[model samples]
Target: MGCLSATRSKAIHKIDIPALDWPMARFPRYKYPLEDYVHENQQEDAKCLEETEDLIHKYNAAGKPVAAILVEPIQAEGGDNHASPEFFQGLQQIGKRTGAALLIDEVQTGGGPTGKMWCHEHFDLPEAPDIVTFSKKMLTGGYYFKEEFKPPQGYRIYNTWMGDPSKVIMLEEVIRVIQRDRLLENVNESGDILMKGLTTLQNQYPQHINSTRGRGTFIAFDGTNAAKRDSIVNKLKLQGIHSGGCGDKSVRLRPALIFQPHHANIFLNKLETVLSNL
Candidate 1:
């Protein structure tokens, strides 16, 4: 299938892969402290959306029409980049006009990591997406699509263990635990604490770090440079906190569903100590 992806700048997930000879549109890059640059960020959104539409038209003109458009609701590996709701709404309209399936890659943001079963639920699209691919926290890789997009015949797509009953059994228990413990609620509560703490740290250490952003516990903050970012991650590991890097210099936080406010506090304190030593 002819496919094209529009992702955020510095997207680590898309690096070093031989991609199809399809188009790549620019994703919006907003200014820090979003409230301070409202007009600028809005313009950024418009520019990116316009570019996306133009690429779809250009690809069609080249005799290789785009059958689908893939995107992440919050570009996780792209430093937790986020776009406004209006931006996603505009994209849906483009997909409708172009008759291209809107395929959302929710592998990184799905299964309650973003305080929602599916991150696109936060976007408020007019209708369900044409396709959604998931894995990672979901315990297995799969795609959900509208009935119209379903293949007419079976075996069109097959895998080694196509009908794995054991995976389903495990997923059932995972679902039960999530619902029984209200993990989504826990994610929200912990996310607030993490976001607030990061914001305060950003304010306090304006020179060392900035651009803290996320939805739920899927959060990140940028370091002053690549070396500083690596240093922070290493130091956090030494302090009994395992963190990772994304994008150019972003320190990402991927906490589990059971993570609570107390856990966030410990993380915040450890992060603060790391920054202080740097």
Candidate 2:
């Protein structure tokens, strides 16, 4: 149906057990801080885009046409890799020209984590993506698509459980609380603190960590190696600050939208302590 990273679908997950054989393309990997490596990162984007176009054309010629191209606003599992707005715009144009739907997977970057309800909003596409799939923090899993992408007949995309209606009620309450408390504003505020703190840490421990980057409460940095990254995560957990690692050596921070500046300060302090110990 759509070409997506194999990393997106857990092998153990039920629905993923019978996945289709779709063409896959490599997502770009950018250097950070993004501002400092703009030229190199732009080149990286161009290279990946070229590869994507080649894959589309090659697959079509082979008579196994790709119906959709799926991508994440931030490649969370693949190391928090991000593409520039221009890169995403070019992708949308390519998808349109090739008659393939562009699907933005916001499973990890949505619900205010990226300072937006949907991370794809930051891309400023000419029009909405053909489809947007979401889960994780949304408290449920589902997808939204344009009318043109709708199934031609009923039951084509139907599921027995569909989804739990009770989950919808809970999600509605969660939405209400988010709006009432203005959690999005809180995420932005805490994100600024986290980013600044991480930058400072990177500067202070250049030999141990580097490449600080993120948006809102979703932040990440690279440890010099996988072993060091695991040690840092384990040490942080012992210090009552749970963190996670991705793409071998990258440590990603997934704080709640309600996380405040003070919480960020606490995390930073604990993180610094762990670094000092290391």
Candidate 3:
């Protein structure tokens, strides 16, 4: 029901769909090296949080109560925008005080890519999210929630495209392999390598790329502008790595959980080669 309404981006202007009249709140933008800009980031988070609460209250007063607070742990499609864990904590409290369910869209940050089964786990929320939606790397699509959220009516949500049970069955085995092989550990190891190597690259090529950020292998860095970002993506593909671009002018990295130290080293070397010529 909310599919058409989910898109809340500047490019939403380009889409000619009849979206619902849901109130939209701004997602916070933070400076990279989150440590260096802690004060500014905290202020940004506070401003967004206040606006979100005001929107919720205004809509409620207008008799259109906010039901669920949906968010991505890291704004993957929104160019990998990230907020501090404290920001999430604030949102969760807002949800609790307002009886709004916290619905985390984990399609881009799930299945152990963030060194956890779900990215929200990093926030240490008081309780599990009211609902957790997942897809993509999980090999199927569905959402899970605490028992309290069970639908009040039967057949409230049903669809033929709920996805194949076989995919879920296969995914069960995939989970086993991930656990048996300790892939989360591998992700952490590779993530360290990526952060270290990317930091070095950022230092060396500040003009071409900057603000390298991400968790685990789900990383990204910005180019000077959209044109340079596209060129970087194209150059990376030419070098035999199928890289992708996201947001306005950012190159994103969404490597598999099985990516290892050697894989990180290879990506770094190839990326360095790309930056060197740029």
- For every model shown, what is its TM-score relative to the native structure? 0.93, 0.93, 0.94
Per-residue lDDT of candidate 2, residues 152-242 (tens digit): 9988877777777888899899889999999989988999999999999999999889988888888899999999999999999999998
Which candidate should be chosen as best, given TM-score against the real structure? 3
Ten-residue region with minimum lDDT total, candidate 2 = 1-10
| Residue-wise C-alpha lDDT for candidate 1, range 1-278, written one tens digit per residue | 12223444444656665557767777788888889989999999999999999999999999999988788998877777889988988888999999888998898998998899999999999999899988888788778899998789998978788756688789889999999999999999999999999999999988788988888899988998989899999999999999989888999999999999999999999999988888
Off by over 4 Å in 3: 9-16, 158-163
Task: Please tell me which predicted candidate would have the highest lDDT against the true structure.
Answer: 3
Ranked by TM-score, the better of candidates 2 and 3 is: 3
**lDDT ranking, best first:** 3, 1, 2
Question: In order, what lDDT does every prediction score?
Answer: 0.88, 0.86, 0.88
Q: What TM-score does structure 3 among the candidates reach? A: 0.94
Clash pairs, model 1 backbone: none
Select the stronger candidate by lDDT from 2 and 3: 3
Model 3: colliding residue pairs: none
lDDT, residue 90, candidate 2: 87
What is candidate 2's CA lDDT for residue 75?
Answer: 91
CA shift at 53, candidate 2, in angstroms? Answer: 0.4
